[model samples]
Target chain A: MEHAATAPEPGPARVAELRRSRPRSPLLRFSALAGVALLVWAWAAGDIYESHLTAEQKGANLDRFLAKLTPAPVRESGDWSDFAPWAVRLLGEGRGAEAVLLTFALATAAAALSGVFALIFLPGAARNLANPDPLGIRGGRGGLAAAGWHAVSRCTRAFFVFTRSLPEYVLGFLLISVLGPDPWALVLALAVHNFGILGRLGAGVGENTPPGPARPVVAHGGGRLGAYLSALLPASFNRMVVYFFYRWETCVREATVLGMLGVVSLGYLITDAKSGRAFDQMVFFVLLGALIVLAGDLLSALVRRWLRYERT
Target chain B: MNGALQRCAGSRRATLLGIALAALLCGWLLGLDPRRLFADGTLGLAGEFFSAAFRPALSYEDPVPGAQPFLLAALRSLLDTLRFAVLAMAVAVPCGALLSFFASSAWWPDLRRHRALGLALRALHSTSRAAMAFARSIHELLWGLLFITAIGLSSEAAVIAVAIPYSGILAKIYSEMLEEHARDAQEALRSIGAGGLAAFAFGLLPRALPDIVSYTFYRLECALRTAAVFGFIGIETIGYRIRLASDEFHYREIWTYLYLLFALVALIEWWGAAIRRRLKT
Candidate 1:
């Protein structure tokens, strides 16, 4: 009791004192070193500091751009308009709503297509599922089947890596070239990238699923496919749903960006307004894009909440 | 119990049906026509693109008359892309860390005890949250375009454009992580009469640090991709070269640039994984 009364309270001050006395953690030291190295490399390689234009010219350019935010005088020669009616017209115009719908539609299609592809390829890419024990097979011919399955798994894994490594914007660019600036080009590009992501995630889920539940079924004369369908799929489906919703959120954002490629989406509207020098209209379109993303975010949140409750 | 089981099952079925219907509606709205997918010579064009992508122009000997070789140009653009992403992350991570301190509810637990302070803190929190949302809501590509218009085509514009939205995203994620993981520890510290910031620093930050670091690495990968996309707007990145090559029908050169971009992403991903493994240990 005496010792307890006499000892330090081990409160914030003590924590600070202890921290000050302790040597710097190796991780912290390593991170600092890495940060310094990165900064040095960035200094050498980044062009942000190396501008050909004089500072005054850059400052003037910034001022001019900032000036665009305010309404220009109503002249016959000018394209700018006052804020009130411009905003009213922006909301009244069905284009903004249509763009939101198009963005949603694109995201939904991409998610659906990617989900299908993920389901198809995930099994092959999962090592545990793809290369099940040969001894568990009914016949002695399991060796050849296992070898073939292993090859398929490797190929599927490679395909996922290849597709996912290429960003959707790059894919959109290539697809636009081939497909001639259609909505399908954006959809396909988004789908290809998402398919890779979802497929890899689903494969990870499959690889990590414990064999305990499925093993009994396999022992009871059920084929591996049957066991997988009955046990593995059900076990992983909830997690897959969670991942899908997360990816859907990202897809919504990507769909909006894809509009910059001349698609008739919110991004396209913003680009159009920018070119026309209608800053008000541009602001309106930007707000609408934000609204759509917010709504998508809200929906995802609600669905995730429901899923959590359902799981419990 | 039997009736309850049946009702639960019915609700589940209905939910599944609702989801299916929504998917169908969305698909219909998109005007997805399978027939048109391969029509109008798209297949041939896509085939050519794919074939050329597989066989990139790597030879330095076959240089175009006065132009730099494809490999050298691609490599340089690749470095530019890396630099852009790294510099942007450098700005974002620290800015986000600062913003997250204000944004996180757990960090301001004592606000309620003092009414005036509570109101001010609430306003600050809401304002910071709104600012982050606004920052992230605009896509990086749009931000890049806006920056280009604002400050001309300087690398500063590109870096700042990427940095703004990325910082917002990082701040939001960081706040959420702190809120989720630090609440209990923070409460304990508060009970011990620790100051808000001190409590967060001592109690919460360590618990949340792993997740924060992991998410940052993920965001860095994303930043790298965005940096490449900025190239499309003439940032002298790999995407710019890709666009130029594709426009000129130099598919081989496009592939070269793309392959380099892919390698960069792959390398980052590998590094991120290693860091995550270390964090786990």
Candidate 2:
């Protein structure tokens, strides 16, 4: 009887059986309605009909534009010699190597500063760690202290929201006006954004921490701060490191974007190449940026591996 | 045990030293100078910029002739940004889904049993993966600039620029989601003689659909941000106006544009959280 039940049914019966077993999903219907609404919105917004040029004309134009972007043969033989000089020029006069180094420096500085800021604000922001009365005190003194801590927690949370909401690009723009187009502007912008992200993540890790280790600290007459410092932070350290590395990856990417704002990074080279109509050079710079980002990703992966190995 | 502890301590020191050396080299190579940080008038300028936030221009006056009023213009720009983002996602999400179907290893369950066919499928999967990586490696800002150069300042350029990299990202993520969830279901279906596509549709897709939807909503929020950034490259979105105001020292106007952007992002964040919550339940 078990063997018979396990066997596949015939086609018609199998289809019916499959249909009967399928779970009802309202999400599908909701998504379809949302998609249709999006389409109607797009239509009304005139994005669908915004372009005046016909499709064929646009295609021809795009083809021509791409044709213009293609680099001309540098030598009669069409060999590597044609590209060697450009590469050399990019490294020497264009300061491609310097740009890469600067990008790395900016990212590292930002990550370091953000890590510090995140640590400073993390206890206050974390819902669990910031609890007003972890000791279950019922007196007037405990109530007042609890109220004060709650206010601090609320303020820190609001700070995180405000900082993270502003994009690094906007921050870079604002910083440039004040800092006079120096590298510090980009560094601070990246730091501010990542600080918020890391702090929020740290707070989340704090909230979800298992009570097994921290409870003892509190039960032993340790203050809330003592419990957090001795137990909660130690427990969440690894997760905080993970978040920091993740943010570091993004910081490298943002550093490149910040270059477009006149900070002498790889982006600046790309911008210059574009203005000069040197499409080949622009492509080269973009490839270089990609390499730097890939290297940063590789480094992060290695660090994560090392951390895991150490843990084990 | 003592020796082992000493060796572990030595290794930890070595790792720390290595990291410190790398940091030092990077800093030195970049000529990291902090003396210029406190340039003349820096504090005053920053103060002014911050103060403007509290007094954002809320007037109905049009900055450009024949344009809408201040609030109306902001709303219009927000709509445009949304429209571009949605259209880009519409293009990206389907293309990404199709690509992921080809890219995911779980979709090709017969690969191990059939050597030649497996080789072909594996090659296709690797190629698709590489293509997606290359597509997303270049940031959207670069893509926007490239499209602007390729086709001039047009909405199509903005939409296409946003679409390409986002499609790559979606494809990479979607493939991972499918692969992670499809294993058990795929085996069950294959045991019953269902074909790859059938197994995927009936088995893998349902389980992965929730995660994919949630991620897509998160990507939508990202796309909105990207669209605003694209405006800085001269697409006439909110960022473009903000840039204009900033360039002309109209800090209040910049704040106004920024507030609109913040409201939009906040709304999307709320919606995304709601959808994710629903998915969880």
Worst 10 residues of 2 chain A by lDDT: A132-141
Is model 2 an incorrect, acceptable, medium or high docking prediction? Answer: acceptable
Local distance difference test values of all predictions, in order: 0.78, 0.76
DockQ of 2: 0.40
CAPRI grade of model 1: medium
Candidate 1 chain A least-lDDT 10 residues: A132-141
Expressed as tens digits, the lDDT of each residue in B1-281 for candidate 2 is 89975775566567546646765665566565666665557767878888988998986333676766787777888788777778888888988887787788765656667999988988998989888877776777888777766666677777888788788889988987876673687669888999887887888887887789878986887787777777777666777777777778888887887777767776766666666666656
Worst 10 residues of 1 chain B by lDDT: B8-17
Alpha-carbon runs more than 4 Å astray in model 1: A1-32, A46-85, A91-94, A133-155, A207-212, A221-224, B1-20, B60-62, B109-115, B182-195
Best by TM-score: 1
* Residue B78, model 2: Cα distance from true site in angstroms: 1.9
- Residues A118-152 of candidate 2 have per-residue lDDT tens digits of 88888888876677656343223576777887898
